[model samples]
Target chain A: MSVTAIRETGHLPDLSRVPLVDEVGVEERSARFQTRSIKKESKVEALRMVLSMIDLTTLEGQDTPGKVQQLCQKAIHLHDAMPGLPHVAAVCVYPTMVGVAKKALGKNNIKVASVATAFPSGMAPRQIKLEETRIAVDEGADEIDMVISRGAFLQGDYGFVFDEIAAIREACGDAHLKVILETGELGTLDRVRRASVLAMHAGADFIKTSTGKIQPAATLPVTLVMLQAIRDYFYETGRMVGMKPAGGISSAKLAIHYLVMLRETLGAAWMTPAWYRFGASSLANDVLMQLRKQATGIYQSADYFSKD
Target chain B: MAGSTSRVPVEKTYKIYIDGKFPRTESGRFFPLEDSDGEVIANICRGSRKDFRNSVVAARKAFPGWSSASAYLRGQIIYRIAEMLEGRREQFIAELHLQGLSKRRAKKEVDATIDRLIYYAGWSDKYQQVFSAVNPVSSSHFNFSVMEATGVVSVLAPNESSLLGLVSNIVPAIVGGNTCVVLASEEMPLCAVSFAEVLHAADVPGGVVNILTGYREELTGQFASHMDVNAIIYCDSDTDVAKEIEISAADNIKRVVNRTNTDWAQEKSQNPYLIKETQETKTTWHPIGS
Candidate 1:
């Protein structure tokens, strides 16, 4: 067997016991999801669902308080002309801007999610990483999106990676911890599955695909592998872990494909924002544009939509 | 006949050009072109409104870069298209002949089309000079109005002359730095697709000119009513359809240019005024030194 079952330590499952991802099968299955014909009333409903599932995010070096506030406003009122639209699931930002986002999003019920733990790299020390996670949680972030140490995981240091995630989960206190695997850097589907299993065992409320910084962030095949891991974890532990495919999901059509994949893989129970989230900012406007097209029976332009 | 070797001919699958690529209509539908005898000559893509919608999106995406491009570069690119067309003159002549034109007429049309492109290429950089104005202002300020390309124009090529009419409508709009989505002649769409090939080989950017082949009745409404389209040029003389287009264009107050009943073959049809049709005049008021 190519995959040998690694020995289990404490509560962590044997790494090898996690099934090896059949790259071909996973890719073919993911491609099938894109072929589903979602049209008319159903398409409108799916667009609404995609809009509701987005974690309107802006994690940039040039990010300012003003930008974060504008994103929050966009999240709160996603197209005022289209009444009865659901607000986004959350507004994701850096740790420092979490407070600003939270204040701007106040009482609107939109969650504030912050990326912590030396995000995009996870290159910081364990103590500082946990401190950053704690500060974001203290700043009233409802969710803490932390990147797993890809370098450590790549070097076969599964124990260190697992422990670090466990510590951050502890530091998160009442907030949800979404573990970003940064699958682009993980290299292979096998490692992505393993990392997903590890994150789940280490207490991740959600397993996100990318940090929106990598070149091939949040692709369908990688996302399919992660969602399958979530499924297997659910069957084994009777716990539901959410899935988020961030980065590069800028079009509403692609977002609908993700929803189809989620429904078929995890059944209808995992169809809401509580179980599925799209960590995309540009995707909101696209969904709005599609909705307007559906309503007006004419093609839409981006000029009318608000900037993220 | 018995000694001659048999060779199979490869027929080209005619497809619509959108965003610089030859793609079958998203609707996956096609209409067969027939000769005067009613025999199937070839199959052309029966473009849908969705295809027009997609082309509008492409034209809108290409608008910013094409609109901001320098006039000199636009002129050079338009000239390059003419050069390419001249190089492929035999192919266009053959296509027009296959589409039921006399060989003599096809040659004449192709030659005239090449000349028309060169004419527009020269005007690309000179039209602003001819149309711009230096107005006398009451205040101590310099006021000058210059021509600016409208964002995206939707054109319905004349059914009478496929190649020449399509080129006449598209070159003027794009030469002035505007991108366009044009529906080719339903009866004679062969040259239009070949012309798209010429554009691809030329330095013209993707989405600068998208060519679709379909019935005008189905697409004319979409072409006129699309909010993203800045102006629409209808060349057919269907008064009722033109009325419908004019009424629908009011939704967005789109500039509708009626070129119906105009002979595209005439020398008087080609001019810089056609370029001005798709351009907006912007006046700048500069403050004088104190």
Candidate 2:
């Protein structure tokens, strides 16, 4: 007889055991969520909710302290001309800028999220990764966005990946840890689901889709698979893990669609910023524009808005 | 078998041209374009606020490249449009005839529109030379005032002279590097749609001249009120509706240009003044000795 289960069903975790997602089914379902008729009052309301859920991010290599300060100010006073608009949930920046962002934000309800551990590529040694996490946490980051070891994950070194996440979580202390799977590199939806489970089990407070540097990041199907994984994880552990579909989600319409997907897949409980977040840089301006349009009944211009 | 069977005639769907693609209105609402004899000619897409918004976006997106394009290149593009229109002469005239015009009158209109395009194409590179001037200033500086295209313009095409009036408004705006969203004449929209095809063939870049076939009453407020639109040109509209446009336009301080009761066939109609209306005058001063 041919030897099936060729790896001898060893200690290593096989992603084949993870629920096989029907690609077409997930796509069709994600598309259906987008088709929901959100207009006028409901649309304005959704825009407001989306504004509150944004993790206003600027993680470029060229990020300066001045830019971080400007971003923090924007998070606090988003469209002051409109009046009565809710600030974004957090200001996301590199670990080095977290202190500047936290200090600039000062006393505001907005949290500071910092990306650490050789972000966009989690390639450094585990000790250095943990040390980076400690620095960000010490610098007063309310949330820590860490990239996973894509090399390890792709090589099926699940234990190494899990252990690194747990170590980083321990270093995170009180700060919420957003484990970026960088699903754009993961290659498939099944891999995304498995990665989400591993991240959650290894102590991720949230599962993020990308590092905002890769192409085809945070696609609806990928986000849907990860959200489902979070849902199933919650079912088993009775603990909620947040979801942030970072990158390529720039439009107000797409943000609202994410909210719709969140509401339907995870229910109304996960609709808040506490459970759902959008890691975006330009999304805040678009939402603010939409809100002003709804208020004034006129399409807006980018010339009138401030760019951070 | 041939005598026993009757064939069903295939009809054309007159969709609005937006962003270089002929898609029906996002609203999915269409109104009938009927002939003077009350015959249903075609169901044209009734443009909604959403369509107007989408067109505005396209125009704004196209503005930078088209406006900054060298005057010589713009002249060539405008001339190319005329060339395309001349080639599609029979098509436009036939469309005009379909919209209730005799062959003689439709032929005249098509010829005039073609000539108008050529006239504007000639002025595209020369209008600035004629309009801009170097001023004698008190300061020890060389000062000059030149014309620049004012971003996106929303043109409400004339109710009558569907083809000629539509061409007249679009030519001057695009000649000056301003992109436009033109609302074609309601009852006689066939020629407008046909002209969009000419523009598409001419390689007049998409979004430079968006054509929509819909009632003015349904879209006037949106066209005037849209904050992104830099200007609104209402051709041959009534005082009350023009006043409403002027008022709605005030919210964004939009330039409301009135081209009412224009004799589009007149030689005087093709002039630099029309081109100057949609342009902003930039004054530059440089120290003479520096």
Candidate 3:
């Protein structure tokens, strides 16, 4: 027999015989435990947790360097005075303000994130987006959140969208690139998924749901679709992309539910701020309130933290 | 539930399907479609014959590397897609709800569709054993038959089952090594477009599976009669369309599969064998020299 025939008919390797980890037992038990957790999260804490994790951008329109510094200092004071402060993931700002956040967060280890890519509306040409991203990276922004060309993406110019992301990613170099899909305008969950995948494929370090500039931003369904895109990208490339549900995430309980969804759907690997972030400015106090309630079992008045 | 009557919003964009990327439609013409509620959704790019031709070119270009890829690797990619789908369940549910399915049914359908992908992903490497055999004819020569993936097949996914039927049909075809051109269900083309994102994530070779979302009746006949299509699968239950496609397929002796209202979920083996059956069998013989 010829070698080709021999190779074809040869005792095809017995793939089924390979010992697999007892996934049946693991899956069943995990499912059972997860179901209970899901119930607890869905019922007890989802709204509260989502409200707490805020992005904390532009506190009272402070454009001056000194004013931005004061804002960071105040944030630090809030962090210190409230022993039960809910852990806000990051303080997002323009590139110039990253240094102030970094200085204020010294030794605290809170992330210093910057928004790039012609913020609010991504109308600039590709080179301009790259330059803006480079400036953000130069400013010591730990993570760079950039917006996709809504015009391009909506125009069905996915190549332009993909190339834009890929170029911005190149400009980021070592800094993480968070590609925003701006799901509100994408208009459908299906479009969100498509955008999410496109971003991930083009080397997005994280996939964000919105720019917080449009109406109907940051719904759970949109976030869910983006997360799935990350998971699928990871499956295909063995690279786990992060998820950021920006725009309207204003509660600790809701943030926690997002975490719960991430944990249950993507497993433990995606639980940290590195993998998940909430972009909101007003959500911090609410998270603290709920955390305090969970801790001391007393409903603290909202004013207790507001006074600080 | 009262708000369920609200129409699912449609995207207003025109794009191309080239090398797994949904770029702007090459010819760049768009037509508007109305939702069940008769509200105009986004203007979908009306794909042209040139777009189809470009997609076929890309698919043909991508066929070699994709078909020759290791089955284990392919399985890994497909399994990753299942993981992604599971994570995005809420989105799928929401989209399906917008497509007019009840919330509970939508959730169930999305979940089942994801599971279906995992089922076929696991079978990427095993179908050859189940489908290929050596026949001992009473001659000095040895005859062995093996199934080779038909180069680039075209597909018409069912309109109703949107997500599940889309995956059910496409996964089997690609897993068995055939690259494809898929016409997304016209009524709910969003999921198919979204699935292209997942495929891109899995690093599926560009052109292995190309999707276009437009009116099926307008496009199906054109797709059916195309010369480049080596095989065509009509997942619709419309008998007349099926008959017409079967006849057109005879022009090129292209393989034709008319899928009925069968439940793909209940099938016994989620292997590539079913997909392989639609392809041509190549048998070779060699004499054992003395």
TM-score of each: 0.96, 0.95, 0.46
Backbone clash total for model 3 is 30
Chain A only TM-scores, each candidate in turn: 0.96, 0.95, 0.78
Off by over 4 Å in 1: A1-10, B1-4
Tell me the TM-score of model 1: 0.96
Clash count list over all predictions:
0, 0, 30
Name the TM-score of candidate 3.
0.46
Point out the worst 10-residue segment of candidate 3 chain A by lDDT.
A4-13
lDDT of 3 by residue, A1-308 (tens): 24222212212122233223333543353344333334433534554334333456652344766766655655565546445444456678887777777887787666678888878788887778788888888878878889988887787777877777777877777777788888888876666777777777677778888888787888766666666667766775687788888877765546665676677678888866667778876666656655564554333334456522
Candidate 1's residue-wise lDDT over B17-103, tens digit each?
999999999999999999889988889999999999889989999999999999999999989999999999999999898888999
lDDT of 2 by residue, A41-152 (tens): 9999999999999999998889999998998888888888988898899999998998999899989989999999999788898889989998999999999999999999
Let me know the DockQ for model 1.
Answer: 0.75
Task: Summarize candidate 2's per-residue lDDT along B1-290 as a digit string, tens digits.
Answer: 36658677788778899999899999999888777788888889888888888899899989999999999999998889889988988988888898888999999999999999889889988889999999999988999999999999999999888999999999999999999999999878888888898899989899998999888898999899888899989975578898899999998788889998889999998888999999999999989874
- Per-residue C-alpha lDDT of model 3 across residues B71-97, encoded as one tens digit per residue: 898888888888888877887788777
Best by lDDT: 1
Q: Per-residue lDDT for A1-308 in model 1, tens only?
A: 11111111126678988898899999899999999999799999999999899999999999999999999999998999999999999999999999999999989999999999998898989999999998998999999999999998999889999888888887887788899999999999999999999998888889999999997899999999999999998888788889999999999999999999988999999999999999997999989999998999877768778886
Q: Which pairs clash in the backbone of model 1? A: none
What is the C-alpha local distance difference test score of each model? Answer: 0.91, 0.89, 0.71
